[model samples]
Target: MDLATIWVTFTSWAGAYSWQVIVTLAIVGLYFLIDRLTIPVLSRSADNARLTESSGDRAVGLARLLTGTLCALAMMVVWGVQFGSVLVFAGTALTLLGVALFASWSILSNITAYFVILLHPTFRRGTFIRVLDADNYAEGYIADLGLFNLKLITENREAIVYPNNLLLGRPCVINPRDRLRGVGKLPPLPPLDVVPNNE
Candidate 1:
């Protein structure tokens, strides 16, 4: 088509969807502003709470994901996408995701627990803790709090990788200060005596 024809087509298209374009831009701009305003505040809160850098980063990432998802949904609505269709698509997607995640349910639980730990100042790195499991009790200094598991350096110089989900379920006694001075030196285990029966 000629330049004049192209100009006419463009103008018609723009005229038809001008409101949608404006609304989309506004939503995007609002998301950006929220991101800019909240990120620094989240970082500072994490720092003040003595949370790990990874925790702060994860929180920021979750926030960004939420903002982006909301903005996209808003834009889709503004562009006249039917809500029923959107709901059906979202439901199907979520169902598939749920099934996929079911096998690795612990991983999902751990991620959720990670956020909980990040928000609550309970189990941070460098704290001494005892997990109250009668059969499999563990006491150690927390070396690092990871998304899936926490690294615990036992008093006996043994490192235990404890799952975040398990950590949340079990009762724990926390010593805010490192008792071993950041060393993993444990008391000696009691000697086991073996007796043999001769027939």
Candidate 2:
């Protein structure tokens, strides 16, 4: 084609899809900005929760996964994917996932609990804790926090892999003296009962 003809063709094509290109770029840029803002917040929360660096990293990874998923969905919408179709597909996939996970409900619970432990101040790595279960009471130093369980090293050196869900439900006693190995001190706890019995 002649230069004028090529130029015309290129301009027409670009004009036809310019909106799509802009929307795509905007969606991607928005995701990047959100990711940058979110990661440090998660990391800071992890630090406040007394989670290990590895745990903080894992939390950041999870946040990234969620962010990416949302961004993908937005891109699909921006690119003119039918929302109803997307919903149907997502629902079907989730229903299948629910059935598959039903048999391993505890596993799912533990995975959820992993984030809870990472973001909450109650359970942290390296501290000593006692799980008060009538039948399976256990005490140990927090060794590692895994996706499905918390690893604990007992005073006798026995390693215990306690499921995160169980820990969440059970009564836990944290030893104030057994702060995280590298963390200098434990954050101050709330008052014993936040009240005095004047009766």
Best by lDDT: 2
lDDT for model 2, on a 0 to 1 scale?
0.75
Off by over 4 Å in 2: 1-11, 48-52, 93-106, 176-199
Give each model's clash number. 3, 0
- Inter-residue clash pairs, candidate 1: 155-185, 155-186, 156-186
For each candidate, what TM-score against the reference? 0.67, 0.69
Per-residue C-alpha lDDT of model 2 across residues 1-199, encoded as one tens digit per residue: 8999999999998899899888889888988999899888878777776666887788788778867886787678767799889878778866765664343454676767777777677666677887767544677888888777898888778888889888888888798454333222334557776676699
Tens digit of per-residue lDDT, candidate 1, span 38-78: 88976776776576688789779987886788688778778
Query: Which 10-residue window of candidate 2 scores lowest in summed lDDT?
Result: 178-187
Error of 1 at 180 (Å): 12
Error of 2 at 87 (Å): 2.1
RMSD values for the candidates in order, in angstroms, are 8.4, 8.1
Candidate 2 positional error at 119, Å: 1.1
